[model samples]
Target: MSTDVAALTPAEARARFRDGLHVPTSGWCAGYAQANLIIVPKDYAFDTLLFAQRNPKPCPILGVLDAGETTGPLLRGGDIRTDLPAYTVYRDGELVETVTDLSEHWRDDLVTFIVGCSFTFEAPLLQAGIPIAHIDQGCNVPMYRTSIRCESAGRMAGPMVVSMRPIPATRVSDAVRITSRYPAVHGAPVHVGDPSRIGISDLSRPNFGEPVTVPDGTIPVFWACGVTPQAAVMESRPPIAFGHAPGCMLITDAADTDYLIP
Candidate 1:
Protein backbone atom coordinates (compact mmCIF):
# COMPACT_ATOMS: atom_id res chain seq x y z
CA MET A 1 0.00 0.00 0.00
CA SER A 2 1.15 3.51 -0.76
CA THR A 3 1.67 5.94 2.12
CA ASP A 4 0.01 9.33 2.29
CA VAL A 5 2.33 12.28 2.23
CA ALA A 6 2.09 14.49 5.31
CA ALA A 7 0.44 17.83 4.49
CA LEU A 8 2.16 20.46 6.56
CA THR A 9 2.30 24.17 5.97
CA PRO A 10 5.73 25.69 6.61
CA ALA A 11 4.60 26.87 10.02
CA GLU A 12 3.06 23.54 10.90
CA ALA A 13 6.13 21.70 9.71
CA ARG A 14 8.35 23.84 11.93
CA ALA A 15 6.05 23.23 14.84
CA ARG A 16 6.10 19.49 14.25
CA PHE A 17 9.87 19.55 13.95
CA ARG A 18 10.25 21.41 17.24
CA ASP A 19 8.03 18.85 18.93
CA GLY A 20 10.74 16.19 18.32
CA LEU A 21 9.48 14.37 15.24
CA HIS A 22 12.32 12.12 13.96
CA VAL A 23 10.79 10.60 10.87
CA PRO A 24 12.32 11.07 7.42
CA THR A 25 11.36 14.57 6.26
CA SER A 26 11.84 14.31 2.52
CA GLY A 27 8.84 15.11 0.23
CA TRP A 28 7.21 16.87 3.16
CA CYS A 29 6.86 20.65 3.23
CA ALA A 30 8.03 21.04 -0.34
CA GLY A 31 9.65 24.19 -1.80
CA TYR A 32 11.51 24.99 1.40
CA ALA A 33 15.22 24.42 1.98
CA GLN A 34 15.93 21.59 4.45
CA ALA A 35 19.02 22.07 6.61
CA ASN A 36 21.40 19.96 8.70
CA LEU A 37 21.75 21.16 12.29
CA ILE A 38 24.66 21.14 14.76
CA ILE A 39 24.55 22.54 18.25
CA VAL A 40 27.58 22.90 20.51
CA PRO A 41 28.65 24.71 23.65
CA LYS A 42 29.57 28.41 23.46
CA ASP A 43 33.24 27.69 24.06
CA TYR A 44 33.45 25.51 20.98
CA ALA A 45 31.16 27.55 18.72
CA PHE A 46 33.91 29.73 17.27
CA ASP A 47 36.11 26.79 16.46
CA THR A 48 33.24 24.93 14.84
CA LEU A 49 32.29 27.96 12.78
CA LEU A 50 35.87 28.27 11.62
CA PHE A 51 35.93 24.60 10.76
CA ALA A 52 32.76 24.96 8.68
CA GLN A 53 34.16 27.94 6.84
CA ARG A 54 37.41 26.16 6.16
CA ASN A 55 35.69 23.06 4.82
CA PRO A 56 32.72 24.46 2.93
CA LYS A 57 32.47 21.40 0.73
CA PRO A 58 31.23 19.19 3.58
CA CYS A 59 30.20 21.76 6.18
CA PRO A 60 28.47 24.67 4.49
CA ILE A 61 27.36 27.19 7.07
CA LEU A 62 23.70 28.17 6.82
CA GLY A 63 22.56 29.92 10.01
CA VAL A 64 24.08 30.28 13.46
CA LEU A 65 22.35 30.91 16.80
CA ASP A 66 23.90 33.05 19.48
CA ALA A 67 24.83 31.36 22.71
CA GLY A 68 21.70 30.56 24.74
CA GLU A 69 19.39 31.58 21.88
CA THR A 70 16.98 29.05 20.38
CA THR A 71 15.13 31.14 17.80
CA GLY A 72 16.76 31.91 14.46
CA PRO A 73 14.60 34.87 13.46
CA LEU A 74 16.93 35.86 10.64
CA LEU A 75 16.62 32.51 8.88
CA ARG A 76 13.13 31.21 9.80
CA GLY A 77 11.86 33.04 12.83
CA GLY A 78 11.25 29.53 14.19
CA ASP A 79 12.08 28.19 17.59
CA ILE A 80 15.14 25.95 17.38
CA ARG A 81 14.26 24.52 20.79
CA THR A 82 11.19 22.75 19.43
CA ASP A 83 11.16 23.31 15.65
CA LEU A 84 13.12 20.28 14.44
CA PRO A 85 11.36 16.92 14.55
CA ALA A 86 14.23 15.11 16.26
CA TYR A 87 17.64 15.68 17.79
CA THR A 88 20.68 13.53 18.67
CA VAL A 89 22.47 14.38 21.86
CA TYR A 90 26.12 13.48 22.41
CA ARG A 91 28.32 13.67 25.46
CA ASP A 92 32.08 13.30 25.43
CA GLY A 93 31.82 12.26 21.79
CA GLU A 94 29.39 9.43 22.39
CA LEU A 95 25.76 9.41 21.26
CA VAL A 96 23.97 9.25 24.60
CA GLU A 97 20.43 9.56 23.27
CA THR A 98 18.12 10.82 20.60
CA VAL A 99 15.14 12.95 21.60
CA THR A 100 12.46 15.17 20.18
CA ASP A 101 12.74 18.13 22.47
CA LEU A 102 15.72 20.05 23.83
CA SER A 103 13.87 22.06 26.46
CA GLU A 104 15.17 20.08 29.40
CA HIS A 105 18.75 20.01 28.18
CA TRP A 106 18.80 23.53 26.85
CA ARG A 107 21.62 25.46 28.38
CA ASP A 108 22.40 29.18 28.64
CA ASP A 109 25.81 28.62 27.06
CA LEU A 110 24.72 26.58 24.07
CA VAL A 111 25.06 27.73 20.46
CA THR A 112 23.40 26.32 17.34
CA PHE A 113 24.67 26.07 13.75
CA ILE A 114 22.76 24.98 10.68
CA VAL A 115 24.62 23.38 7.78
CA GLY A 116 23.65 23.11 4.12
CA CYS A 117 22.46 19.67 3.04
CA SER A 118 22.48 17.85 -0.31
CA PHE A 119 18.68 17.61 -0.11
CA THR A 120 18.67 21.17 -1.44
CA PHE A 121 20.17 19.87 -4.67
CA GLU A 122 17.96 16.79 -5.04
CA ALA A 123 14.96 18.77 -6.31
CA PRO A 124 16.99 20.18 -9.12
CA LEU A 125 18.47 16.80 -9.96
CA LEU A 126 14.96 15.34 -10.27
CA GLN A 127 13.88 18.32 -12.35
CA ALA A 128 16.80 17.70 -14.69
CA GLY A 129 15.74 14.08 -15.18
CA ILE A 130 18.44 12.59 -12.99
CA PRO A 131 17.20 9.64 -10.95
CA ILE A 132 18.17 9.49 -7.30
CA ALA A 133 18.23 5.74 -6.69
CA HIS A 134 17.63 5.93 -2.94
CA ILE A 135 14.59 8.18 -3.40
CA ASP A 136 13.16 5.79 -5.95
CA GLN A 137 13.77 2.83 -3.66
CA GLY A 138 12.47 4.65 -0.56
CA CYS A 139 15.77 4.49 1.30
CA ASN A 140 18.33 6.95 2.58
CA VAL A 141 21.32 7.86 0.44
CA PRO A 142 24.46 5.87 1.19
CA MET A 143 27.23 7.67 3.08
CA TYR A 144 30.82 6.71 3.86
CA ARG A 145 33.79 8.08 5.70
CA THR A 146 36.70 8.77 3.35
CA SER A 147 40.44 9.09 3.77
CA ILE A 148 40.12 12.73 2.63
CA ARG A 149 41.17 14.98 5.51
CA CYS A 150 39.36 18.14 6.52
CA GLU A 151 41.16 21.31 7.58
CA SER A 152 41.46 21.33 11.36
CA ALA A 153 39.97 23.84 13.74
CA GLY A 154 40.68 23.51 17.45
CA ARG A 155 39.28 20.07 18.27
CA MET A 156 37.28 19.65 15.04
CA ALA A 157 39.60 17.77 12.72
CA GLY A 158 38.50 14.54 11.07
CA PRO A 159 38.26 12.68 7.76
CA MET A 160 35.57 13.85 5.31
CA VAL A 161 32.33 11.89 4.98
CA VAL A 162 30.51 11.65 1.65
CA SER A 163 27.12 10.57 0.29
CA MET A 164 26.90 8.42 -2.82
CA ARG A 165 24.39 8.20 -5.64
CA PRO A 166 24.48 5.94 -8.66
CA ILE A 167 23.95 7.70 -11.95
CA PRO A 168 23.84 6.49 -15.51
CA ALA A 169 27.31 6.98 -17.01
CA THR A 170 25.73 9.09 -19.74
CA ARG A 171 24.12 11.46 -17.22
CA VAL A 172 27.08 11.92 -14.89
CA SER A 173 28.15 15.17 -16.51
CA ASP A 174 24.60 16.49 -16.42
CA ALA A 175 24.30 15.80 -12.69
CA VAL A 176 27.54 17.66 -12.04
CA ARG A 177 26.50 20.64 -14.20
CA ILE A 178 23.14 21.02 -12.53
CA THR A 179 24.34 20.64 -8.92
CA SER A 180 27.41 22.83 -9.35
CA ARG A 181 25.13 25.86 -9.43
CA TYR A 182 24.35 25.41 -5.77
CA PRO A 183 27.74 25.39 -4.09
CA ALA A 184 26.22 26.01 -0.70
CA VAL A 185 24.68 22.55 -0.68
CA HIS A 186 27.78 20.58 -1.59
CA GLY A 187 27.81 21.26 -5.29
CA ALA A 188 29.19 18.83 -7.92
CA PRO A 189 30.60 15.33 -7.68
CA VAL A 190 33.64 14.65 -5.60
CA HIS A 191 34.41 11.21 -7.04
CA VAL A 192 32.80 9.20 -9.78
CA GLY A 193 33.53 5.58 -10.73
CA ASP A 194 35.71 3.46 -8.41
CA PRO A 195 34.49 3.58 -4.79
CA SER A 196 37.61 1.93 -3.37
CA ARG A 197 39.82 4.70 -4.76
CA ILE A 198 38.33 6.90 -2.06
CA GLY A 199 38.79 4.20 0.59
CA ILE A 200 35.22 2.90 0.35
CA SER A 201 36.11 -0.77 0.24
CA ASP A 202 32.59 -2.06 -0.17
CA LEU A 203 29.62 -0.24 -1.64
CA SER A 204 27.25 -2.73 -0.05
CA ARG A 205 28.40 -1.78 3.43
CA PRO A 206 27.99 1.95 3.92
CA ASN A 207 28.98 3.70 7.13
CA PHE A 208 25.63 5.50 7.25
CA GLY A 209 22.38 5.33 5.27
CA GLU A 210 21.36 2.43 3.00
CA PRO A 211 22.93 1.27 -0.22
CA VAL A 212 20.88 1.53 -3.39
CA THR A 213 21.20 -0.37 -6.64
CA VAL A 214 23.80 0.49 -9.25
CA PRO A 215 22.56 -0.91 -12.52
CA ASP A 216 25.14 -2.28 -14.94
CA GLY A 217 25.33 0.93 -16.93
CA THR A 218 25.57 3.20 -13.90
CA ILE A 219 28.54 4.48 -11.92
CA PRO A 220 28.68 5.54 -8.29
CA VAL A 221 29.21 9.26 -7.73
CA PHE A 222 30.06 10.85 -4.41
CA TRP A 223 29.48 14.30 -2.88
CA ALA A 224 30.53 15.97 0.33
CA CYS A 225 27.85 15.34 2.93
CA GLY A 226 26.56 17.30 5.89
CA VAL A 227 27.24 14.25 8.01
CA THR A 228 30.91 15.22 7.83
CA PRO A 229 30.33 17.74 10.59
CA GLN A 230 28.62 15.20 12.80
CA ALA A 231 31.52 12.83 12.25
CA ALA A 232 33.90 15.59 13.20
CA VAL A 233 31.88 16.24 16.31
CA MET A 234 31.99 12.56 17.13
CA GLU A 235 35.74 12.48 16.78
CA SER A 236 36.19 15.61 18.81
CA ARG A 237 34.05 14.21 21.60
CA PRO A 238 32.96 17.50 23.05
CA PRO A 239 31.26 17.53 26.45
CA ILE A 240 27.90 18.01 24.75
CA ALA A 241 26.83 18.19 21.11
CA PHE A 242 23.48 18.09 19.34
CA GLY A 243 22.57 17.36 15.74
CA HIS A 244 19.45 16.62 13.69
CA ALA A 245 18.80 12.91 13.48
CA PRO A 246 19.80 11.44 10.13
CA GLY A 247 17.21 12.10 7.41
CA CYS A 248 15.37 14.52 9.73
CA MET A 249 16.23 18.04 8.59
CA LEU A 250 15.14 21.54 9.42
CA ILE A 251 12.75 22.84 6.75
CA THR A 252 13.64 26.49 6.36
CA ASP A 253 11.97 29.52 4.72
CA ALA A 254 14.77 29.95 2.19
CA ALA A 255 13.87 28.96 -1.35
CA ASP A 256 16.04 26.51 -3.27
CA THR A 257 16.34 29.01 -6.10
CA ASP A 258 18.15 31.38 -3.77
CA TYR A 259 21.06 28.94 -3.70
CA LEU A 260 21.57 28.97 -7.46
CA ILE A 261 24.15 31.60 -8.30
CA PRO A 262 24.27 31.18 -12.07
Candidate 2:
Protein backbone atom coordinates (compact mmCIF):
# COMPACT_ATOMS: atom_id res chain seq x y z
CA MET A 1 0.00 0.00 0.00
CA SER A 2 1.22 3.50 -0.82
CA THR A 3 0.67 6.40 1.53
CA ASP A 4 0.19 9.89 0.11
CA VAL A 5 1.91 12.80 1.77
CA ALA A 6 -0.52 15.14 3.44
CA ALA A 7 -1.24 18.35 1.52
CA LEU A 8 0.25 21.47 3.10
CA THR A 9 -1.32 24.87 3.46
CA PRO A 10 0.70 27.80 2.17
CA ALA A 11 2.11 28.72 5.59
CA GLU A 12 2.56 25.11 6.63
CA ALA A 13 4.25 24.30 3.34
CA ARG A 14 6.72 27.13 3.88
CA ALA A 15 7.35 25.91 7.42
CA ARG A 16 8.04 22.41 6.11
CA PHE A 17 10.63 23.86 3.72
CA ARG A 18 12.35 25.82 6.51
CA ASP A 19 12.42 22.63 8.56
CA GLY A 20 14.72 21.17 5.87
CA LEU A 21 12.42 19.82 3.16
CA HIS A 22 14.24 20.45 -0.09
CA VAL A 23 11.93 18.69 -2.53
CA PRO A 24 9.78 20.32 -5.22
CA THR A 25 6.42 21.40 -3.72
CA SER A 26 4.44 22.72 -6.67
CA GLY A 27 1.37 20.40 -6.89
CA TRP A 28 1.34 20.11 -3.11
CA CYS A 29 0.64 23.76 -2.38
CA ALA A 30 -2.38 24.40 -4.59
CA GLY A 31 -4.29 27.68 -5.14
CA TYR A 32 -1.50 29.85 -3.70
CA ALA A 33 0.99 31.84 -5.75
CA GLN A 34 4.34 30.18 -6.47
CA ALA A 35 7.21 32.53 -7.41
CA ASN A 36 10.74 32.50 -8.76
CA LEU A 37 13.09 34.03 -6.18
CA ILE A 38 16.21 36.19 -6.76
CA ILE A 39 18.51 37.54 -4.08
CA VAL A 40 21.38 39.94 -4.67
CA PRO A 41 23.38 42.45 -2.69
CA LYS A 42 21.93 45.96 -2.22
CA ASP A 43 24.53 47.35 -4.64
CA TYR A 44 23.02 45.39 -7.54
CA ALA A 45 19.36 45.59 -6.52
CA PHE A 46 18.52 48.64 -8.61
CA ASP A 47 20.13 47.27 -11.73
CA THR A 48 18.42 43.91 -11.30
CA LEU A 49 15.06 45.58 -10.75
CA LEU A 50 15.57 47.65 -13.89
CA PHE A 51 16.48 44.54 -15.82
CA ALA A 52 13.26 42.89 -14.70
CA GLN A 53 11.18 45.96 -15.48
CA ARG A 54 12.61 46.35 -18.95
CA ASN A 55 12.13 42.68 -19.82
CA PRO A 56 8.71 42.28 -18.33
CA LYS A 57 7.89 39.34 -20.58
CA PRO A 58 10.54 37.14 -19.02
CA CYS A 59 11.09 38.83 -15.64
CA PRO A 60 7.72 39.90 -14.36
CA ILE A 61 8.21 41.69 -11.03
CA LEU A 62 5.86 40.44 -8.32
CA GLY A 63 7.19 41.49 -4.94
CA VAL A 64 10.55 42.87 -3.79
CA LEU A 65 11.83 42.52 -0.20
CA ASP A 66 13.91 45.31 1.24
CA ALA A 67 17.55 44.83 2.14
CA GLY A 68 17.93 43.05 5.50
CA GLU A 69 14.28 41.95 5.39
CA THR A 70 13.38 38.31 5.00
CA THR A 71 9.60 38.50 4.73
CA GLY A 72 7.80 39.97 1.71
CA PRO A 73 5.53 42.83 2.76
CA LEU A 74 3.49 42.91 -0.45
CA LEU A 75 3.22 39.21 -1.24
CA ARG A 76 3.02 37.39 2.07
CA GLY A 77 4.28 36.95 5.60
CA GLY A 78 6.60 34.14 4.47
CA ASP A 79 10.31 34.20 5.21
CA ILE A 80 12.57 34.47 2.18
CA ARG A 81 15.56 32.85 3.87
CA THR A 82 13.66 29.65 4.67
CA ASP A 83 10.44 29.41 2.65
CA LEU A 84 11.99 28.11 -0.55
CA PRO A 85 12.74 24.37 -0.83
CA ALA A 86 16.11 24.81 -2.59
CA TYR A 87 18.41 27.72 -3.44
CA THR A 88 21.21 27.99 -5.99
CA VAL A 89 24.04 30.22 -4.83
CA TYR A 90 26.16 31.74 -7.56
CA ARG A 91 29.60 33.33 -7.20
CA ASP A 92 30.81 35.48 -10.10
CA GLY A 93 28.18 33.87 -12.40
CA GLU A 94 29.35 30.32 -11.65
CA LEU A 95 27.14 28.02 -9.60
CA VAL A 96 29.31 27.47 -6.56
CA GLU A 97 26.76 25.77 -4.31
CA THR A 98 23.16 24.87 -3.65
CA VAL A 99 21.64 24.85 -0.17
CA THR A 100 18.29 24.27 1.48
CA ASP A 101 18.76 27.11 3.91
CA LEU A 102 20.24 30.60 3.47
CA SER A 103 20.49 31.63 7.12
CA GLU A 104 24.24 31.06 7.17
CA HIS A 105 24.78 33.32 4.14
CA TRP A 106 22.16 35.92 5.01
CA ARG A 107 23.49 39.45 4.94
CA ASP A 108 22.17 42.82 6.07
CA ASP A 109 22.85 44.28 2.62
CA LEU A 110 21.10 41.51 0.67
CA VAL A 111 17.72 42.14 -0.98
CA THR A 112 15.14 39.61 -2.18
CA PHE A 113 12.87 39.80 -5.24
CA ILE A 114 10.08 37.39 -6.12
CA VAL A 115 9.19 37.21 -9.79
CA GLY A 116 5.99 35.76 -11.26
CA CYS A 117 6.09 32.14 -12.38
CA SER A 118 4.42 30.11 -15.15
CA PHE A 119 2.89 27.87 -12.49
CA THR A 120 0.49 30.74 -11.79
CA PHE A 121 -0.87 30.43 -15.31
CA GLU A 122 -0.92 26.62 -15.48
CA ALA A 123 -4.03 26.36 -13.33
CA PRO A 124 -6.19 28.14 -15.89
CA LEU A 125 -4.77 26.09 -18.74
CA LEU A 126 -5.77 22.90 -16.98
CA GLN A 127 -9.13 24.42 -16.20
CA ALA A 128 -9.65 25.27 -19.84
CA GLY A 129 -9.34 21.54 -20.59
CA ILE A 130 -5.78 21.61 -21.90
CA PRO A 131 -3.42 18.82 -20.96
CA ILE A 132 0.03 19.68 -19.58
CA ALA A 133 2.22 16.80 -20.80
CA HIS A 134 5.11 17.30 -18.39
CA ILE A 135 2.77 17.42 -15.41
CA ASP A 136 1.08 14.26 -16.65
CA GLN A 137 4.48 12.62 -17.06
CA GLY A 138 5.61 13.77 -13.61
CA CYS A 139 8.64 15.57 -15.03
CA ASN A 140 9.94 19.13 -14.89
CA VAL A 141 8.83 21.59 -17.57
CA PRO A 142 11.31 21.86 -20.46
CA MET A 143 13.19 25.19 -20.61
CA TYR A 144 15.48 26.65 -23.25
CA ARG A 145 17.83 29.60 -23.68
CA THR A 146 16.72 31.38 -26.82
CA SER A 147 18.59 33.61 -29.27
CA ILE A 148 16.10 36.27 -28.10
CA ARG A 149 17.91 39.17 -26.42
CA CYS A 150 16.66 40.96 -23.35
CA GLU A 151 17.03 44.73 -23.11
CA SER A 152 20.18 45.43 -21.08
CA ALA A 153 20.11 47.13 -17.70
CA GLY A 154 23.48 48.33 -16.48
CA ARG A 155 25.52 45.09 -16.38
CA MET A 156 22.55 42.72 -16.38
CA ALA A 157 21.75 41.28 -19.81
CA GLY A 158 21.43 37.86 -21.45
CA PRO A 159 19.37 35.68 -23.80
CA MET A 160 15.71 35.12 -22.95
CA VAL A 161 14.90 31.69 -21.50
CA VAL A 162 11.55 30.03 -22.23
CA SER A 163 9.49 27.16 -20.83
CA MET A 164 7.76 24.98 -23.43
CA ARG A 165 4.56 22.96 -23.56
CA PRO A 166 3.21 20.90 -26.42
CA ILE A 167 -0.40 21.84 -26.96
CA PRO A 168 -2.84 20.55 -29.58
CA ALA A 169 -3.29 22.94 -32.48
CA THR A 170 -7.00 23.21 -31.76
CA ARG A 171 -6.40 24.21 -28.14
CA VAL A 172 -3.52 26.64 -28.71
CA SER A 173 -5.89 29.56 -28.75
CA ASP A 174 -7.50 28.36 -25.51
CA ALA A 175 -4.10 28.21 -23.89
CA VAL A 176 -3.48 31.74 -25.01
CA ARG A 177 -6.81 33.06 -23.73
CA ILE A 178 -6.50 31.41 -20.33
CA THR A 179 -2.93 32.58 -19.72
CA SER A 180 -3.54 36.08 -21.06
CA ARG A 181 -5.57 36.90 -17.95
CA TYR A 182 -2.42 36.61 -15.83
CA PRO A 183 0.00 39.08 -17.37
CA ALA A 184 2.29 39.22 -14.38
CA VAL A 185 3.25 35.56 -14.80
CA HIS A 186 4.50 35.51 -18.38
CA GLY A 187 1.19 35.59 -20.16
CA ALA A 188 0.48 34.18 -23.68
CA PRO A 189 2.57 32.16 -26.08
CA VAL A 190 5.78 33.64 -27.45
CA HIS A 191 6.09 31.15 -30.29
CA VAL A 192 3.97 28.36 -31.65
CA GLY A 193 4.22 25.70 -34.42
CA ASP A 194 7.97 25.85 -35.11
CA PRO A 195 10.75 25.55 -32.51
CA SER A 196 13.38 26.60 -35.06
CA ARG A 197 11.69 29.97 -35.42
CA ILE A 198 12.92 30.87 -31.92
CA GLY A 199 16.36 29.23 -32.42
CA ILE A 200 15.44 25.95 -30.73
CA SER A 201 16.77 23.49 -33.28
CA ASP A 202 15.72 20.30 -31.54
CA LEU A 203 12.49 19.46 -29.74
CA SER A 204 13.78 16.37 -27.92
CA ARG A 205 16.48 18.30 -26.02
CA PRO A 206 16.36 21.33 -23.75
CA ASN A 207 18.90 23.26 -21.67
CA PHE A 208 16.92 22.81 -18.43
CA GLY A 209 14.29 20.36 -17.19
CA GLU A 210 13.19 17.10 -18.80
CA PRO A 211 11.63 17.15 -22.27
CA VAL A 212 8.12 15.79 -22.82
CA THR A 213 6.70 14.08 -25.85
CA VAL A 214 5.31 16.13 -28.70
CA PRO A 215 2.45 13.83 -29.53
CA ASP A 216 0.73 13.66 -32.89
CA GLY A 217 -1.56 16.60 -33.70
CA THR A 218 0.21 18.75 -31.10
CA ILE A 219 2.59 21.71 -31.60
CA PRO A 220 5.20 23.17 -29.25
CA VAL A 221 4.28 26.43 -27.55
CA PHE A 222 6.74 28.69 -25.74
CA TRP A 223 6.48 31.32 -23.01
CA ALA A 224 8.91 33.72 -21.38
CA CYS A 225 10.28 31.89 -18.37
CA GLY A 226 11.31 33.08 -14.92
CA VAL A 227 14.66 31.38 -15.46
CA THR A 228 15.61 34.35 -17.65
CA PRO A 229 16.70 36.23 -14.51
CA GLN A 230 19.00 33.42 -13.50
CA ALA A 231 20.66 33.47 -16.93
CA ALA A 232 20.99 37.26 -16.83
CA VAL A 233 22.48 37.19 -13.34
CA MET A 234 24.98 34.60 -14.44
CA GLU A 235 26.04 36.72 -17.40
CA SER A 236 26.30 39.82 -15.21
CA ARG A 237 28.66 37.82 -12.99
CA PRO A 238 27.66 39.30 -9.69
CA PRO A 239 30.02 38.65 -6.79
CA ILE A 240 27.30 36.63 -5.08
CA ALA A 241 23.69 35.94 -5.96
CA PHE A 242 20.96 33.49 -4.96
CA GLY A 243 17.96 32.08 -6.83
CA HIS A 244 15.38 29.39 -6.22
CA ALA A 245 16.34 26.17 -7.95
CA PRO A 246 14.34 25.63 -11.13
CA GLY A 247 10.86 24.12 -10.54
CA CYS A 248 11.15 24.67 -6.78
CA MET A 249 9.24 27.94 -6.41
CA LEU A 250 8.39 30.03 -3.37
CA ILE A 251 4.71 29.58 -2.52
CA THR A 252 2.91 32.74 -1.39
CA ASP A 253 -0.47 33.42 0.25
CA ALA A 254 -1.69 35.53 -2.64
CA ALA A 255 -4.31 34.03 -4.96
CA ASP A 256 -3.87 33.73 -8.73
CA THR A 257 -7.10 35.67 -9.26
CA ASP A 258 -5.60 38.65 -7.50
CA TYR A 259 -2.82 38.91 -10.09
CA LEU A 260 -5.26 39.55 -12.95
CA ILE A 261 -5.51 43.31 -13.41
CA PRO A 262 -8.47 44.82 -15.26
Q: Using TM-score, give the best candidate's number.
A: 2
lDDT score at residue 173, model 2, on the 0-100 scale: 89
lDDT by residue for model 2 (21-54), tens: 8766546555667789889999999999999999
Q: Estimate each model's TM-score.
A: 0.93, 0.93
lDDT of each: 0.83, 0.84
Q: What lDDT score goes with residue 104 in model 2?
A: 96
Q: Which residue runs does candidate 1 get wrong by more than 4 Å?
A: 1-8, 74-77
Which run of 10 residues does model 1 get worst, by summed lDDT? Answer: 1-10
- The per-candidate count of clashes, in order, stands at 10, 0
TM-score of 2: 0.93
